[model samples]
Target: MTSLPADDIASPTSTWDLVPATVLSTTETDGPDRPEPRPACEDVRPVIAGHRLIGACADGPRAAQLMFVSDAEGRLARAAEDGSVEPGCTLEELAGDLARSTGRQLHPENPGLRRVLLVRLDAPELPLLAALSGTGFTAVSRHGWSVVVFDGELDYWAVRTGLDETAVVLSSDGATRSFEVLLAGEDPADVTELDSADAVCVLEWGPPWQPAGGLPAGSGRTPAGQFEQDLVRLCAGGTSELQIESVASVFDLDPAETNRLRNYVGGGSTDLVLESVLQLVGLPVLAAKIAEGRREMADLEDARHYEPTAMGPALLRGMTTEPTGDGLMARYQRAVLRRPELLLALAGTEAALGLGLAGAARRGGSGARVLGTLSAALLADAAAESAYWATVRRARRGSARAVPAGLLRRFFGLPEG
Candidate 1:
């Protein structure tokens, strides 16, 4: 596959900071680490179906019965024969063909956003794929889709690298163990031999190497199993080691954590929840605190939660609040919490940028106007994050605090304080 030159790829502002490692990778630390880079296609089943292949590679399943990476060069034709699989049509054309052949356009299959993808066929290395495959089974899923996301996030098994643009993995029904390529909507695809007397071909995408767009809005927010919900149940039904093991397997409990968990269960103490398990494993409570801090700030920002009477007191201000979750907001807060000095630093940085942009804003050029607008936004971010730190500090504690509502109201004028 011909690599897109740096100049050819359109980059968003967020990506500009990345010091890319390869022609395609988003970061300097990333790139194809697998040998026989022979490009990513030929590394896998060469000549898939009847078309020539390149930069394709496969890994055993992580979440599914048999999983493989359909890299930018890999997405499958799910062929009957194993020679180069070629895409010969758009997704609309192929879907239309299937509609004609099957006598109906199959209803859209929503692979609930809790991505069952266990494999990072998109990983930079092949061997690491096997090693890291078992991970993500218990991770918190963000809209970006990874278990590594901060708490209260949508739980997921793996981060999807390029689901829209390629066959990121071969997912079986887990019951049939039979692989089916279900590419929906419209895009370029390769369905080589549906009409052939003796061949099978199914799958397609808009373009190779170019990941055109993201999953449709609100489409990537669902949880896979009731794991999030089951966490609630697991906490309630802490009766047997069997139940413990079952949840652990779903989460792919870390070996050490798993051992400790068994020891915990064996000790005969019940009443475990997701929070308890996280605590048992020594995963930091800081993650939850950070999430709480962000949620608090979001509440403060929302007009619906505003109480004029509570304006003077910090505690009441928080009481009448109902902040919806914003993972991105949480992400920014998490980063600030990790390196708090950066939050302070953001102020000075924004001030400096604001000074620079003010003159440009006065000049009235479109580029300067854009820069001025972004600078003002940056300033707002710096201010919000600075204020956010106070909430986090108030949230900080070794254990839950209570029993001071009246005292705080009388002395501090903030009952919740």
Candidate 2:
């Protein structure tokens, strides 16, 4: 690879206010023992599949996998032993391809997200560094990915020379591993096959790093799996660990909280759903308060059973109310509750599905048909709130009276308007 001027690489404009390191060794008396560089451990060899290097490694209790793609290689690899050439990829084309696989963790056979990656490229390191840095990666060393996985912390040299990307070790599905690249000082002339893993390539962003365009309006008629994919894509957009984890599994949430949100959503107002999800994932104290409030609401529901007249004042005020397991609300609320992080998107989806199911139930649609229709809707992009409320507007039945949005918001402690 031609050596690019170091100045070509973009650096952080400001220094991070890092936490002070605890000084030990000969610190106070003799200037701290020059910090030692951590050892490198490249314990695994990842398979080079097309343009991406996919592999897994473990260090004690921590484990991670790597899915590294190079744009130049994807487009230029030979087809067979006779060496028929394949079309090379443009920078944007390659970036989009990589993002689709990486964004949803559905490629290379559902590897899920990993803690680290081991990359080898022959091009200028600037572009790849930028992408990883923007995605919250910290370069721990020059020795390669293995050593950093074992130590879980970078040496002074790695920190000083590398971008100030913060590294967070999250719970991963594979072995604990570190990410290191095989570039920096290697010779391009010594490189053998361009398609081979040893061949180096530079990475640059494409016009679309991931899938493009806004989510479509959801309906029973949506193409199979589109809505579910939208939900998964929403999870990928999250920046915090809590946001990421919460979206990973809806079943991980508390049953009571899901139940409460279910009733409110059934009543045709998903206004507070986003705030509730944020609190559940990022602020436990607030979540506890919400839970406590829900408990009080539950108590009121119990009171309604014994003193229906006594609860009239509260009901007239449009408070958030709980519905029974078999109620119209539960039919979709429980389904959407499983993935609360998507509550915003799902609010409209659940409403649309509920409407279809309601008509189906009245028209004597079979259980299988009702459930199958709902299943399809769940996987498609949810409808907008306006769409959901429109359906509520057309409702003339007494049952719809229980779904007043203002009362529901008040009962759930949501702000007015």
Candidate 3:
């Protein structure tokens, strides 16, 4: 078998900086590998009689199947005669002939495949049509009434019929196949010819497919809330691979959520969460900054004794005690007082502003006002700092002056300056 390219084998590293310690170790151990096989398809047949064909693979140890069904007698006859064989047909013939050849009755001498219908359209519709040929039985092309015939087993028919928008798969065996085209506004009875000697047929259709229960309300906040709850639970200590799985499992969150969370973690947002907790606990600015910074980059052992700065101590004291009342605003004020350095950091970095710290401070109270002032100071400080660095950076260029001594020497014809 051909191997996958080396690049395809690679897994992305975790971007989140604050991954649980357990996850870090486990991720290192697990690395990249192929996934395990899914469950096999069992004996499932197309749902005939409702004007649709749906079935599952019976023999294969695979999760999906192929099906072929046709209502058009002329197309069926052409498929059987030309033997040119369509791209996806596994078996094809008139319904009667197909049954006689296979020693099975598709619909017991009805001469027309009544219940089974396969949708057939031009090649351009292949992508949507191919989606139907997957794991389960579902009604497709509901408005089109059609019939289907098959020489292969029901599972094969189910898989093959799924390719209606494209040609059917033809095997090396004498059996030929063609996807039944579901014509617009064409009555099912008008298309069939009773006298055809060879044909295979089955019929099916039913309740329409419903994707997910329904869209969630208010910008889908329900799902987001659920996701947040899952994260909160996972973070509650005793964290393990199981916790990550639990977070991942809720409502089958798609790949996008996984990538988003990874980015949040990678961009040091999780470190901010930890910092938020410290601020809540009344840590002063210097103390919190040192602690938060250490949390961001320092080894675990050094994290405990981080010292609080004067601003940090004052803010923490002000927010946590006496002059403060209790409520949402109060808590926010305290958080602001305790984390002015966070504001400073935010003001200094455009990246932090995008994260919303600056906006949050503008809306806060007296403590928030302090944070706003600190943010301005930080921004100005950053501008000055950048100017200083720019000057330093250009110092060498300025120092490389066109020395008057060299020109003087040249003019005077002196050997040296």
As a whole number from 0 to 100, the lDDT of residue 130 in candidate 2 is 29
Report the alpha-carbon TM-score of model 3 versus the true structure: 0.13
Q: For residue 35, give model 1's deviation from the true position in Å.
A: 46
lDDT of 1 by residue, 212-309 (tens): 11112231122211111222232122235554554455446787777776665444222122224446533433222222222222232211211112
C-alpha lDDT of candidate 3 relative to the true structure? 0.27
Question: Number of the top candidate by TM-score?
Answer: 1
Please identify which of the two predictions, 1 or 3, would achieve the higher lDDT against the true structure: 1
lDDT of 3 at 391: 32
The TM-scores of all predictions, comma-separated, are 0.23, 0.15, 0.13
Model 3: per-residue Cα lDDT over 19-69, one tens digit each: 110000001223368444332211112111111211112111212222222
Off by over 4 Å in 1: 1-175, 179-337, 355-378, 384-417
For candidate 2, write residues 77-123 as lDDT tens digits. Answer: 11222222223333344335544543311123213223232222111
Q: Rate the local accuracy (lDDT) of all candidates.
A: 0.29, 0.28, 0.27
